[model samples]
Target: MKVTLERTDLLKSLTHVHRVVERRNTIPILSNVLLRCDGGQLALKATDLDLEISEQIPAHVEQPGATTVPAHMIYDIVRKLPEGAQVSLETSGDNATLELRAGRSRFALQMLPEADFPDITAGEFSHAFTLTGRDLRLIIDSTQFAISTEETRYYLNGIYMHTVTTDAGERFRGVATDGHRLARAEVPAPAGASGMPGIIVPRKTVGEMQKLLEDPDAEAQVEISEAKIRITTGNVVLTSKLIDGTFPDYGRVIPQNNDKTMLVDRDDFKAAVDRVSTISSERGRAVKLAISEGRMVLTVINPDSGSATEELAVDYESDPLEIGFNSRYLLEITGQLRGDTASFSFADAGAPTLIQDQGAEDTLYVLMPMRV
Candidate 1:
């Protein structure tokens, strides 16, 4: 393949596709990116068997052809080159090496047969919909933190996506949980997603897809089938195999009758919990939350270390209650709240506590209390 492309443009495209390439590979072709020059564009593709990413960038084609070259090495070489430098890439014969040139620098990179690269076949998707980049990013950032890293519960290692209709109407929802905490968020459902089947998007795929949605103004096209899911935006496409196992029914973990309600400044509460937890090296970083008529106190105790307590004025009228929770879980849930105030509802110290963003009911967080 012989093509001439600007260094800045090439690096930008490589930045997107190179991340999908595995750093270490048992198969030789897996470490290389498939480059195809056709129709005034250079298409770069990379995959790690389970996930594949492809990007097309504008280029001047001298001799149209295709070849495979090391993904990371080429990325680094182009990245270090002077800005706006013109890059020329050409491959000699069938088994010949790949030649790269820019100004006074030139290098010959080993090439691999393009036929050895694994290809992911696009499946027949039963449902396809579009979402704004801002909305998609909200769903991922709000719930991805709660996805479990536990290998045994493979289903919980991804965000669960499906369509649900409230008493009002149908809405698109995303749910994620580890054993200790759960997060759920909803947005307006797309026109054709009414009967879409629920799917667990694996953790790695969620990350890669999220990266592509960084442009808040861009829109993403999502396609889902029984076995896999695909997301496309601009010149980029990402496809991944869905986790086959079933996700736990998360509704049961959310408490409905929690009567005690406490409203506190979100930042203040986060700061208090963060400070108090520092004293308790043991007890699994537990911090006790004591709520009374109009005051809330955070306390942490460790015999070998020390104890800490901080008080803050809150909006609570329920009976006094004291509950223990892991500090890390509390911070994660509260961090997702974009507003200034945070509300918590509790039944007792042993029951799960429900958290919400003051007046917003569309998003909810549930935390399992710990025994102190």
Candidate 2:
């Protein structure tokens, strides 16, 4: 195979496929990227058994062929090459090595037979849909932080995605919970998504998909079945195996009748929590929020560290409520609010508190209280 491409174009393609290549692999071929040159295009592919990503970019093809080479090494070589320089890659039929050349630099990389690469089976998807990059970014940014890292639960280790019917109409929703906290966000369901089965998108897939959705103007085509999910853009395609577990009914955990409510400036609340959390215990990082009439005081006390307090005025009229929660959780949820005002609904210190953006009703967060 012989191909010539500008450094920038080759580097971009490498960045996308490299994410799927593991630093260490039990199978030697798994650590290498499959490169195929034909029809004036170069296809780079990488996989980690469970997930696969492929990118195709324009290149000058002098000879048509394919080979596998260390994914990271080639990417690094091309990346460090002089900017705008032309890079040439070639491997003769008798050679088991890939020769890379750019200006005054050259390197010979060992190649594996393309036939040794594992095949990724992407069965027919039951549902196919399209979504703007903006819609996908919103759903992932809002809920990804709350996904469970606990391996024991397995099911909570990803974002739970499905379609739901709201008072306004039907929407696509993403929910994540780690028992202590839960985040739920939704966007109007796109066309072709009707009756789509809910799927748990694994954490790694969520991150890689997020990267592909960075271009706000790009549209992503998504296909899904009970066992796997695929996302395709103009330049790349990513496919992954779905987690084989059922997500718990998250709707049941959201507070239903927490009538007492308070509206506070999102920035003020976040700042207060951050300052008071300085004195919080290392293990719990707990902060107590005491709200009364029209004032809210955030206090943190640790046995080894001195206590700290910060007060923020809020629009609270209900009876006083004192609740303790993980300071990090509060900051993360508040950061997701798009508007200046963060609305909080409370039932008591013992029950979960519901929080939402006063200006955006599509997103919601639930936080379980800890005993102070």
Candidate 3:
């Protein structure tokens, strides 16, 4: 196989495909990327058993063939090569050595047989839809932070995706929780997704898809089967195995009777929480929120350190209530709000508090209170 590619184009493809290769692998072939050259394009693929990414880039093909090489090694070599250098790769028939040349530098790298690479297979998708990159980014960023990191509850380690009917129309909802906090976001459901089964997209897949959606104007084609999910955009394709677990009924956890309400500037609330958290205990980071008629105060206390309190004018007319929460949790949820004001509803000091961005109807958060 002999091919020539510009440094910039080759690096872009390598960076995208290399994300699928794990730094360490139990199988040698799994650590390498499969490169196939034919008809003026080079196909690069890498997989880590659970997720696979493939991309094709334009290249000058002198001789068409296929081979496997160390993914990270090749990426590093190409990344460090002189800018605008023309890269040339050549390997003789049945040979395990790959010759790489660029500028005044040359290197011979070992290659693995292309036949050794594992095939990632998926069944026929029951649902396929298209979402603008912006909509997909909102759904992912709003919920991914709340996904559970606990290994035992494997079911909660991913975002739950399904179609739901709202007053306006049908929409796709994404929900995630770690038992303490929950985040839910919705976007207009793409056509043909009506009867699709709810699926839990694993944590790693969420990250890879987020990276692939960096172009806000690009559209992504999503295909969902019972056990697999695939996302394709531009010249790239990513396939991942869905987590094999049932997500809990998240609707039940969202409170409906919480009537007491407080509206405050989102940035002000976030800043106050950040300031008071300086004195919060390291283990729990608990901060107390005291709300009353037109006033809200945030305070944190630590036995070894001291205490901090900050007051802010708010729009609240409910009975005076005091609630405690983890400072980090409050800050994270508040930071996600897109509007200037954050509206919070409460049942009491002991029940879960519902938080929503005042002008955004597509997202909401629920946080269980902690005893101060």
Highest lDDT: give the candidate number: 3
Model 2 spans with C-alpha error above 4 angstroms: none
lDDT winner, 2 or 3: 3
Residue-level lDDT of model 1, residues 339-366, one tens digit each, is 8999999999999999999999678999
TM-score of every prediction relative to native: 0.98, 0.99, 0.98
Give candidate 1's error at residue 295 in angstroms: 0.7
Indicate the TM-score of model 3.
0.98
Residue-wise lDDT of candidate 2 within 83-148, one digit each (tens)?
Answer: 989999999888789999999888999999999998675578999999999998999999999999
The global C-alpha lDDT for each of the candidates, from Candidate 1 onward, is 0.91, 0.93, 0.93
Better of 1 and 3 by lDDT: 3
Kindly give the number of clashing pairs for every candidate: 0, 0, 0
Cα shift from native, residue 317, model 2 (Å): 0.5
Sort by TM-score, top down from the best: 2, 3, 1
In model 3, which range of ten residues has the least summed lDDT?
117-126
Which residue pairs show backbone clashes in model 3? none
Poorest lDDT segment (10 consecutive residues) of candidate 2:
117-126
